[model samples]
Target: MVALRGVTRTVRLPDDQELHILRGVDLTVNSGDHTAVVGRSGCGKSTLLNLLGLLDVPTGGELTFLGTPVQHLRDSARARLRGEAVGFVFQQFNLLPGRSALDNVMTPLLYAGGKQFWRRREIAMDILDRVGLAHRARTMPTMLSGGEQQRVAIARALVRRPRLILADEPTGALDVDTGQTVMALLDTVATESGAALITITHDVNVAALARACYRLETGVLSAAAIPTGANA
Candidate 1:
């Protein structure tokens, strides 16, 4: 679980201007919960995702992950925690060039060590199957269609069975039907594993699937009413 209180992320531009990306954002995500954040472009959705995933530290306020204050942890400790608990699904799929679907999914386990490292291939294959990509395990990203590539990315993200799943516009690059199927797949898999799912998207249809919803604009976050299954 992760919690943010009065969190602010400010970036110093090259010209020495301070650009505030997140301002007074307060949110708490519990285990097994499904949450969605809807925002327009340039509204800090990605910034919020980065902070939640431990890719960046906030400029002010507090962020706690699994009851530990992120600010107090050493850089090494924070990274270890992130690798062990966080899974990210990007809009672009972010598959490594030249790697087969199976290889891409196995990349995460290479850092896992012990039994996980030794069983990386087996584990990756299972996840690929879970995403219905088992048959395409040997296929390269360029050879796969957009939907197939996204499925591969999903398989990679879930291979670790992370406790928190952060999906940033996961279906943004897919066609409507493909997006719907992929989003449903991601939600189902994350829920089955009891991982808290936080989807960042601008699509109301996407937001409708979540148990709770929020609209983020101009660096501020607030609860928004979204009828469950409304746009599904």
Candidate 2:
């Protein structure tokens, strides 16, 4: 449901020089597609995510969402579309400091409008249950363990059943087993809902969960082969 062709992002430095972030990147993600983007730090992976999430417009090139050119959309329209169509999970968990798990999850629904807003509590509770956090629904982020916090974040992201899920370094703070479980949860949820999943990570194991993978380096994106062990 997303396409990018020759996408480029350049930032103007304080010195008045241009710094290229992404150059000539091409990508396509359809419903039910699981795509992984692997890159080292400062390789523009986050920049690409910002463009896909509609947080930033491409400096140049064609970027489209559901066949509509993103560059042509206004900030308000972009924000509206992003709220309705996309879900984001970050490595930091980014939970509200003082909100309970349930409350944090319901925050998105508050701005979602219609049934989602009216039934926010029920919807949020159901998703937390699905993520196996029903018992901790009242727990604060500080009281929960890292794995639990991440699960809560995932539940929050999925509370509204967004059509696209963007996870950036989702497993960074968890142990191997916890990381595996988190990735599995994301894959299963996306598959069941027919939503596309895009994971941005440096770990090959995390990237392995995706059906297709790409390596981003020096602002360029290219097809990546699943590692030998990843094939198993």
Candidate 3:
């Protein structure tokens, strides 16, 4: 559902020097595919995720989503596409401070019109149930535990039935056991929904859960071998 060829991202520093974030990165993510990207803290994984999520444009090369070229799309068009086809889960859980869990999940439907928007409450409730957060629907973010908040975030991301999920350090703030549970839930939900999942993480165990894995270094992405008996 996504493709990138020789993609590059560069930004001008305060001193007029150019900072290259991604260099000729090539990647393709098909429907129902699970891919993992592992990299150090400053190796440009976030830049790659922004490009894949349609939140930013590449400085050079090509990017397409479901066969349509996206590098030249206007900001509004790109936002529309992202709303319709992509879901995002982040380490920070990005939930609006005062919104209830159900309301948070329903936020995406405001962009999805007609039946989806009209039935957003019902749909959001169902997704909350799927993520085991039905009872917490009325709860505020501060009232919930870290794992519960993340679960709500996942529910919000999946409520739109998006074709692609971009997760960045989804389990970074959780304990080991909670992280495992969250990852398993993410995998299960993506598979059940037939959405491609691209996870950005620094954890090797997290990367092992994907069918394909790559490590980013020096602004480059290269495939990494999964050890024998790896989960993927």
Best by TM-score: 2
Question: Which one wins by TM-score: 2 or 3?
Answer: 2
Residue-pair clashes, model 3? 0
TM-score, cand. 1 vs. native: 0.96
User: lDDT of candidate 1?
Assistant: 0.93
lDDT of 2 by residue, 1-232 (tens): 9999999999999999999999999999999999999999999999999999989999999999988898999999999999989999999999998999999999999898788889999999999999999999999999999989999999988888999999999999998789888999989998988999999999888988889999999999999986433435
- C-alpha lDDT of all candidate models, in order: 0.93, 0.93, 0.92
What are the runs in model 1 whose C-alpha is more than 4 Å off?
A: 227-232
**Sorted on TM-score, highest at the top, how do the candidates line up?**
2, 3, 1
TM-score of 3: 0.96
lDDT of 3 by residue, 58-153 (tens): 999999998988977899999999999999999999998899999999999988899999999999999999999999999999999999999999
**Per-residue lDDT for 171 in model 1?**
86
